[model samples]
Target: MAYNAGMTEIQPSRQVDLAIIGGGAAGVLTAINALRAAAPGQRIALFEPASAVAQGIAYATPWPEHLLNVPAGKMSGFPEQPGDFLDHLLARREAPEATLAEQYVPRLDYADYLQQRLAEAAAASAGTLQVVHDAVVSLQPQSGGHRFQQAEGANWQATQVVLACGNSMRPLPLPAGNALPPGKVVDAWDYDGVRMLAGDQDLAIIGTGLSMADCVVSLLAAGHRGRIHVLSRHALLPLPHAHGGTADFDPQPLLQLPLRARMRQLREHVRIAQAQGLPWQAVMDRIRPLGQALWRSLEEADQRRFLRHVVRYWDVHRHRIAESVHDQLMAVERSGQLQRHRARLDAVLVQDANLQVHGRGTPPFNVGALINATGVETRALGLRNPLLQQLLAEGHARPGPHGLGLDADPDSGQLHDAHGAPQPGLWLVGSLRIGTLWESLAIPELRVQAQQAARAAIA
Candidate 1:
């Protein structure tokens, strides 16, 4: 009934209860959740421009070498359909042992699972939930409120446009400008670019986060044996996962104390965990919900402080890889094929056949191929992306506070349009929401967000 729903916005026009942008995980998840929250015939459409319509960047990997970082058990998307992905993997013969074990399966399995869900959801709705593969370059509000135009020339008189741009590429701030030699800098997602590396060629990767780990794994899988020097402002690689030797205890009484005090007590608890042969990862995961609640209790400054200081440490400690990948990293380290430098960049210069980046610190920052593994740029709200640029230029939308991402209220998911008003017909989700929702990356967190967004649209 969304397509025929009454207009609650400016002027009279058309409607598609909700128009979600960026067809990746966020978009599809949003569509599915909206379907859950929709009336019998509520109209919804998702736009994803990748090669596959429903399969976003995660599953878009053509190479079988790339693997999902999470275990199959944890990777199952829906909270209720716990073994859905595992079942699909078994049915398709992708992973016979994956269902029972906590093994990290191929990224393709998860991608296929998402595609399967899209197909099932579509079949169930027929008309209510439709998906469009076109990319939305920009959105401009019409004379009436909440009405807008799609960059592809589609007249979208949408009641709400939810921006689910999953992960924005981190800009390469080369000191001498953003130009690199022919084969120097590469975005991690360029499947073809990553694969083209000769087995003998060495590459320099930047950043020391999970994505950096993924890139390292990708290089190893491709048989790249050359030395890799991963440099970053803070060269702290993600912590390893728990050994899972059975240690689960809760802070029964200490949890009732004040937030900061509770945080300290939790750290103390983890120390005890470490002494008891428990993995730090287990401690971190056990404390996640508590951390989130504590985070909410903190003032804005404290939140900003957490972002500046504690978040990275927490990320590495909390979200981790399987033992297999960790072993590979350790092997690379022991073999001296990999080097980590905690150096701050002073300048970057690229010349013929050679790429050089200058930094201050011991060992220094020197490399041939520099991979901008710094991850996505969260604060670029008014940058050069087609849709984002136009929205800011036309005063149709504004960047979120803290300049982290597109601003939206958590309760309503209503986007802050350019006029500094919460636009009912607009929503923002995914990693694009890191500024507001710090724990927005994992599949479980994303599923909840998508469900919330869908429910809000109908309400």
Candidate 2:
């Protein structure tokens, strides 16, 4: 690896047993698991560009209103130790009550928990675990291992590389030839920037997913009295988790069915559960464990059909909000402070200091600001990350099924080259494997993937 001319003095090339990219939850967990599985003195380097590790875009929020969608009991960093997170909370006196398992804590709290866990893992590794604060820009296959080049021209060689670069926010789907006006539009995750807007400024939020819900909670918490408009193809918000807790149901029988039949079974299950005085969420919870397996069982065409027709509905039901947050959203809706529209955004134009948002089958509307909460871009080819772009361009990796993310082995997470051959020593975890495993995003699935990736890399 060569450094750019006239750049600052480059550091000497470092060697490591494993190199994990991106310091989000996935990366941190992979490092911890790798450290635990590695032999004594095995070097592990985690490359994260941010000043802090494990606080990825999701957990980096400072607002207490941004809470985890999952309950505390299920948010353990280690799958083998299911109560680790709860134990940490108890030890820190953050939530001293033993009954705090069902509590939905702030996302920042989870970030802190993950950071602490990373620190503990580092200490236990006895200087073998190193957190390199730099962005990896490119990767190349070398004679004995892989060479990773950083943004500042530093390079490192590792016998194995785990691509745990999580998710990236999708760019606003603005119409052709229309550029988003600066200062008038913000990413929904920009909590501080969104809160800085005047309370009376009318805001239009694109997409009614979890991020949109978070924005609503943040705006309400900030005492915003603006007329908030939410626009999506189907203006459906996420349902709240059952207050009575999840119920028992069997998803095994439905696993072999096709997409349509499987969905019918799910609907019938929900109906029966509701008639039997159980919340519909119970059925979803039962199916959670089998989500990825069922997804993989589908034919490629059926999988694509599911993505086109069933994904939105599944997401709204599967990923729910906290009951308190749901109540707040309902209160705002009942007070006429919030409005939901079912229309696809077509264009965004700057009309003076305001934004003119055009939608299909609706007249253009003006808003003081627009927030893009359309969620992460799943199509791997469209990502802007230099490393991913280079990897795909050079045939180091290919797009996963349905173009959702990088293509990798479902069991081992070993990356597949453009020609569909598994690339040895190259693994992918977290949301990057969403194409291979439909339920790869959340902690429950990620922890398992982290462990598997570490073991595979070490093997």
Candidate 3:
């Protein structure tokens, strides 16, 4: 297989057997599976605007301080080969601190592992796989398949298309016409910008989620000694993972209760597990696998209520960080370097040389830089992806539950059109399935979806 480094203007008009869009972890995994399962002469195209594949927003961070939230053992790219990621780390002698299965490795090393896996998959496959460096702007349904129009280079058709673009960052929540002060407010997604701030300049991070935790770690790693003000509605930070343990709790019974009752029952289970000398994380781990099933069992109204009131608490307990990171955050808090506020940011005032972050019931605090760590935009209505915009505009696709993502068949990831019809040869994977599957963004779910979508496309 030959990988094209750049897009070319002139090319023969040939439709590919399969086209996997996005080039991130999801797309790369799908391409790998497709390449292995495709016929001898089948051709697959993996489109990524980036120079390389597998370095999506999540894994593109260059800082070693940014570690994978999950353990190395559970971060494998292939489901059948459960130890592939851990094996890769050992083979390259890149396992830092510890060589055990539960070691938390740097996300940069994970990106390298993904790239290597992609290369090996392409090399060993009987089918031809070519990576096209281009952004797909528009995808229109055609007679036999779909036609993809790229921002650069020649447009082409594909027998099947897999939309694997990851989630987009939500815009800063500010009042209409309230523009952010230029250069003073940096998004957390811009790793370089966040890490390059002046060491002594006080900063304010907008959220208290994992992204905020990451920003704090990055700044501390960069030798920053400024006051970091973290603000959120709940003022909650992600909990730390347990050292190592398992809880034999069954989550099926909770599904039979109402949303609030389920939550109550879940808390009871956690209490029981704690009484039995098990960490709360162990109970959460047991429930993690059944998250989607439990989510789908709730009525839409109950689901909305859960989102509005219970999501923050659930997130802090469910998506935990490594014990080391959690400890660092605690040290900073105790040293008066990190301050947490339970409030919402209502406005930002440009005062002299600093930004004044204001929220109801809280006094305005001045900071040299403000970081937007509000997290990904789950709602699909105002998405900035051109292809997604076009799809919704033309009624080619509809939003998923609670308008979080594009609607698709939960089993095969086959996308459904506006009329509730499943579009042939069209599939979706990754965070885009959040509305349909609550546990869609993690590697375990992504690898499974990628494999299933690939097999279905090939079949």
Candidate 4:
């Protein structure tokens, strides 16, 4: 067995007990639990292109102002020890004012926390955990388990493999043959690029979700003070989080109703709760725990209807941002520097030195740059990711409900083949299970899924 101190260049063993395909939070958590549960002499390898583990696109931001959407108390990597993250923060003095569990620390800090946890798990485990800084391009089932091919490494086999590839940002949805200047369009996730934009340069950000919020906050932190145009088909900013109070609201009753009716009933219930001096946040928090079950209760058609009609509203309310962050956004909006549009982007035309963004309902406008923050690329999963493409191209996996993600057994995180047979020794966690489990991407769900997948893999 061989190992390197940091991202390894040491040749991998011919076989490993488990192979995790990504090194983001989900993959790191899965690795931590797998190492803890592994028998002596067992080998686990994690493949990731990033030089460091756990800093997925979400947590790779360098700015201190980019805080975790969830509070520190609830962002623990291990479900059994829910206070682990808070404890780490206190020990490191990362959150000096974090006497309460509600403190929202920097996202980069969370990355550090995961890296440290992974190190601790590796040191304490009886098994060998290899951090392979390589991107796995293809995975195929072999005699006993699966064979993995990486872009720049020796092929290896693993008896159990977990795909925690995480989320892919949707590219700019531009029409074919649209004339646009090169380098004018930037990815919303590229905080380094976004923060470096010339101050006072008018900018247009496409998407009105959490990613957009992140872009806005980053710009403000960087002292960007120019007309910022935020455009989306339905221009809606996420609501702010509210503290205090609990609600005993049950969503089981609404499960019997159709999707549309259920939404209406939920609205009525929220209004009633508000009238009684109970915060809507309390009711929302209650629904969040049962979100997957409620989603599963709906028929396929009803689920589609919910996605089309109600998911946006649910997202804005359910995935609320920190109040402090929300206030900063609102302050910019109130000052007339930040503006939002309810329109669909059609084309980007280069005019003189600026980019003219054209869209329906909203007149054409010129901005120095365009930022794409449209969030996840759910529709064309295979097209965007090669590993996913190979999995779908072959019969190793099939699309999940609505073709949003790969199909997997929600309970065990086991992948299902095209023929609907469970592929033994193969599993997936995090965003890949989005279609099957509506609430599968967050830390709470990912950690649980990681624990389950690890236990199964090691067993």
- In candidate 1, what are the lDDT values of residues 84-128, reduced to their tens digit? 767777776654564444767777667667767766665565337
- For each candidate, C-alpha RMSD in Å? 5.2, 4.1, 2.3, 2.3
Model 3 residue 435 CA deviation in Å: 1.1
- Candidate 4 local Cα displacement, residue 169, angstroms: 0.7
Ten residues in a row with the worst lDDT in model 1? 1-10
Model 3 agreement with the true structure over 1-459: per-residue lDDT tens digits: 223355322343357889888998899899889988988878888888888678788888999999899999899999999988888888767545255578888988877888887777777888777777888988988988899888875788999999998968877778988787689888897999999984998999998988998899999999998899999888999999996477886678988889989888888988988999898888888888887898888989999998899888888998889999999999999999999988877998888898888987578898998998989888999689998999999998999989989999988898999987999999999998888887899898999999999999977
TM-score of each: 0.87, 0.95, 0.95, 0.96
Question: Candidate 2 residues 358-382, lDDT tens each?
Answer: 9995678888999989998889987
Score candidate 2 by TM-score against the native. Answer: 0.95
Q: Give the distance in Å from residue 24's predicted Cα in candidate 1 to where it truly belongs.
A: 0.3
Q: Which segments of candidate 4 are over 4 A away from where they belong?
A: 1-11, 94-98, 380-383
TM-score for predicted model 3 compared with the true structure: 0.95
Q: Between prediction 1 and prediction 4, which has the larger TM-score?
A: 4
> Cα lDDT of all candidates, in order?
0.67, 0.85, 0.86, 0.86
Query: In model 2, which residue pairs have backbone atoms overlapping below 3 Å?
Result: none
Locate the minimum summed-lDDT window of 10 residues in model 2.
1-10
lDDT, residue 430, candidate 4: 89
Q: Please give the clash total of every predicted structure, in order.
A: 9, 0, 0, 0
Q: On TM-score, who's better, 1 or 2?
A: 2
